[model samples]
Target: MKISIPFLGVLFLVTACSQPQKSSEAGDAESAQSKFAHSPLVEHIYTADPSAHVFEGKIYIYPSHDIETEVEEDDMGSHFDMKDYHVFSMEQPGGEVTDHGVALKLEDVPWASRQLWAPDAAEKDGKYYLYFPAKDKEDIFKIGVAISDRPEGPFTAEPEPIAGTFSMDPAVYQEGEDYFLLFGGIWGGQLQWYEDQKLVEGRKGPTDGIPADEEKALMPYIAKLDGSMTELAEQPKEILILDDEGNPITAGDNAKRFFEAAWMHKYGDKYYLSYSTGDTHFIAYAIGDSPYGPFTYQGNVLEPVEGWTNHHSIAEFEGKWYLFYHDTELSGVTPLRNIKMAELTHLPDGKIQTIQPVN
Candidate 1:
């Protein structure tokens, strides 16, 4: 749901360059908190990119299920709207969410159609993997893994797609028994920032940047699933977006690559990597010690939502730390995003703190 990097500088653009003034009603952003609090958090429908999960103790939320299309004039084709995903849950920390209907859809995904975008939910061995992204039936754009032993789903897809995955947000991080997943960038060009040129898969135009020996083919891949978690048990590599003297961020310089949704967590021992800093509006991060990194960007934690792309996810549940994300300021357009959340701190010696986007 991102990709505007007007030339990489404003931190990396995504609301397709802005001019969007929308959001003005705060009087009743759902009565100002306490229905459960923290974020536009979900009022009736519209959601996007979130993907959190604490599971059995509650904090679920699979997001990316915003719909509102009377055929608006976004002309950029489908407006990235979406067909289904709703799976809120909550129960504690800021409490009250629960909406679990239609866990995964796009007509039940046979080879996919439309463009279902962003998703992630893992549990492994016991079963519950959702990793999504659609546009197949030859329209191309891979990424799919649906199985479910119940994480609120009628989910069952896996008839294909994921074999070598093409692109589009599809997070999934397990670590311990090893899971990984995380996907590619967009921006009309599946973006590769600087020397790695992209956008030519589901089609988008005019690129012309690949060099540094093709900069590891542009970066951002991961892969390592298997256990029948819907395929790709290995062979995906790429993550090396380095530079603090480690080198590897190509396209010539100005660094901070990886212009996609690409999340990934794990606080204490390090390894953050957040994303979505394409054309501007913020939402970045970097720091590394594993999980295929070469990272080191470390900056911009978020601050850019009033419509124009801002996909996110950074859970912690029961002990605090939230930050779902999305903002059209309530149907302010920008694909009518919605779904928000705030309250994410950390600035002691650990980093992260720039949130700003509440009611």
Candidate 2:
């Protein structure tokens, strides 16, 4: 039997943004070498925000288990809990997977105290590290790290925040020489940018060049981590605020320009940073030659499909890179999402081919 949990609203946004239009240069998508071989039919797995690490030749997918229960209507006024962590193990060849049961429960942690959200897990040395965002003392959200000897964790947390309240949805990367963590930007009202008091004609608005008037909008941010991968510190360089063509998308009305669900991986000489755009359930991408990027936005990679929001994870396994994401097809057009996968292809010119579900 399959167990279903809800609470994934933005997890499938990449699919929402990745709709395929027949390219003038291509044969049908099926004829393309890069399309996914198959797509799954499942629902409410909330297997959103999926992160996989191959352990001893097995791939495990860990996602927040925000299970809902039948309770009195008066008690229904409650926030979801990240109390359960679900694990899925994939079989070979067909990539068929079996649900591995709840691997960890938040109520099992004394300090966790409240809501749990996105989690990214990786294996280092002989241990598995899981980094996630959860509520701290004042009920404010912060990122924290946990360590376990196995991929399916009974993880233990450190005494402090690995990344501060300003950070969430972290993707950790270790290049040849250093370690880094990428996260969504905080809406630091004071950090916003603006044009001079003398508004320029034809410009019609602030032309300060910083997108979103970084002074007033939420932009994605990154921090460098030490070799130990614990502390989150400001990098030596200036903070990166997501901007489109030197103009900031700073209006409160335009906050969706910021990237969410960001992860960076370097292939050959290029680094691909994938993210979900806005809450419209769309996914977009950018590319950079370096980890610390002057990345050029490549536009939305996935658009909403069926009823699913667009969001995804890119992973390389057994020499193949795949996009792992979720969709809302079976549960109609709501937040209930399911797990899906597709093959990812990179071209010689440093451009990545957009991924789509197998028909």
Candidate 3:
């Protein structure tokens, strides 16, 4: 675990220097009639990053449950060890998906106790929040919010979090009455492991190399949320996902910009944003008009999913447009992944259509 460097040299933060591997533990998870029409609509349970929401009209989701890593051999079990969260409703989008089991857990969050990572779900005025990026009892990694009225949830958290945000994925969007809150991308390391894991906010550069401005890569963070989804209706903005003449497209082998799983939606007058290009496993997008963004990257709606973390959540339900990602091919367990969906096609210059995963 030591990496205090003088020449840790040759190590460009392979997620803090890779070496934790193995995926032979899990065996029984592959049912639901044996999957495959596009796979992973929940094959027993091993879900991953999906956020997905449509709430009252159906399509609910909100994943992150993959707990199959005993850790000991090369240890990276905490690599993404989520504790709970399982809201899975559906009325369409391939139909029949309802596993509303435990909509929030990690000891019911009193400030989170584990790495219950990558989450997002929203609905206001009538209430139904759920947004987490866990690890609190001083394990750091903050960003919380849970309060439910049902979307298949018993949610009711908020022991203290969502104050000045920290790191990890936590998407939320709701234009018109305003409530943005997109979280960070310290997903792999840089900005000096996001300032030595204080998780970004000044004076922490070069945790390895290559940051002469990866298109103003400030380590993914965004804000705007005050109607009591938990505070911070302003003062937070570092999003940089452009590149078409708009600029700021870091080009890390180019999967468009801004890594980490950001996910915002709206499609007619435009305001897309979709993230998770972090270390490039796909799921890229950007094309804003509001909801705070200079966005424009416009490409890859969901392409490279095998696993290294590429989160998602985009809805539509009865009218279609789906893309809730996650996959390590049914838990060969690259950090224990699962959840997958495909079906997003739109054209006429608004652009979006690049799906490929369904083995």
Candidate 3, residue 279: the lDDT equals 60
| Model 1 residue 122 CA deviation in Å | 22
Per-candidate TM-scores read 0.31, 0.71, 0.31
Give the candidate number with the greatest TM-score. 2
The sequence of per-residue lDDT tens digits that candidate 1 reaches over residues 299-352 is 777866665677888888867787787776545666766666676887788898
Stretches of model 3 off by over 4 angstroms after superposition: 1-50, 53-60, 63-84, 94-99, 108-111, 114-132, 142-166, 170-193, 196-240, 249-284, 287-312, 315-320, 323-345, 348-359
lDDT of 3 by residue, 202-241 (tens): 4333233335544355546678888887888777777666
The order of the candidates by lDDT, greatest first, is 3, 1, 2
**What are the lDDT scores of the predictions, listed in order?**
0.68, 0.55, 0.69
lDDT score of model 1?
0.68
TM-score pick, better of 1 and 2: 2
